[model samples]
Target chain A: DVKVTQSSRYLVKRTGEKVFLECVQDMDHENMFWYRQDPGLGLRLIYFSYDVKMKEKGDIPEGYSVSREKKERFSLILESASTNQTSMYLCASSPGQGVVGELFFGEGSRLTVL
Target chain B: GESVGLHLPTLSVQEGDNSIINCAYSNSASDYFIWYKQESGKGPQFIIDIRSNMDKRQGQRVTVLLNKTVKHLSLQIAATQPGDSAVYFCADGNQGGKLIFGQGTELSVKP
Candidate 1:
């Protein structure tokens, strides 16, 4: 079974603070994604990386960035956290190339900005 | 311009009954669809997937049906149980591998 590990299960931060959510996948999947899940809004993609040091902006990428320095690890950075940014963040990974749709996801990190 | 939405926000069913969750998508160009189940405090897990060309696919006790004509998709879970209580989301994927997820339908199974 594939395992996606998230560094934090819950986090609390003040406004204007910087935050980092880390994710690591055991399988050698080439595609990694970061998404935010909110009530009534569903899951919206924040950023995705297809390869090491390569990243692409998703639908909602403002105030967020990602770093993929290695194959197993991917990180999401919130440059300046705000109250509006309080939400559950999810990390997922999938195999590279082909019509890949099945994504293995890690336990999400719930961030609360005060 | 592209969106996926659920017809019902919540559904409640008795144990051992069948459950159906409906989803609609606006993008006709979507090549495939996937169903994900998310339990409380956990991320969404892949349940099943169906290609656009195929209308129905079954896995374990779950079945996924896709209708291109109406741009609709549905997941049918037979014999609902307490473990099946979770938020179910249908996502549409394009060739680029980007998925547009629906505002999930919460299924509550009464035991």
Candidate 2:
């Protein structure tokens, strides 16, 4: 079974602080995604990287950025965290073209920006 | 704009009863669809998936039905159990591989 591991299960930060959420996938999947899950809003994509050193902005990318320096690791950075940014962050990976969009997800990191 | 949305926000069913969750998508060009189950404090888990060409697919105790013409999708669960209670989301994967998720349906199973 494929495993997507998240570095932190829960985090709390003050406003204007910078936060880093890390994720790693065991399988050599080509696509990695970061999403934020909010009540009533569902899961909104933050950023996605298809390969090393490549990243694309998703629907909601403001105040957030991502890094994919290696095949197995992807990181999401919150430049200046705010109270409004408090939400659950999810990391997912897929096998690109042949997989038909089935994403394996890690246990989400719940962020509470104070 | 393309979006995926669910018709109902919550569904309550008794144990041993069947449950149906409905979703509607706006993008006709979407080729792949998936159903996800998300428990509290965890990320969404893949339940099942159906391609555009196929109308129906079944998994253990779960079934996914897609209606391309109406752009509607449904997931049916047989003999609902307490463990089946969770938030369910339907996602659409477009040609570019970007996934759009629905608002999700919260399934509550009563004993």
Best by DockQ: 1
Candidate 2 clashes between residue pairs 3 or more apart in a chain or in different chains: none
Model 1 pairs whose backbones collide: none
Model 1, B11-42: lDDT tens per residue? 99999999999999998888788999999989
Q: TM-score of the B chain in model 1?
A: 0.97
Evaluating just chain A, the predictions reach TM-scores of: 0.97, 0.96
Question: How well is each residue in B1-111 modelled by candidate 2, as lDDT tens digits?
Answer: 789999999999999999999999998888899999998777889999999889999999999999999999999999999999999999998836778899999999999
Candidate 2: misplaced stretches above 4 Å? A97-100
Clashes of 1: 0
B-chain TM-score, every candidate?
A: 0.97, 0.97
Candidate 1 lDDT at B85 equals 99
After TM-score superposition, the amount by which residue B105's alpha carbon in candidate 1 deviates from its true location, in angstroms, is 0.3
Lowest summed lDDT window (length 10), candidate 1 chain A:
A94-103
TM-score of each candidate? 0.97, 0.97
* Per-residue lDDT of candidate 1, residues A27-96 (tens digit): 9999999999999999999999888998988999999999999999999999999999999999999986
RMSD of 2: 1.2
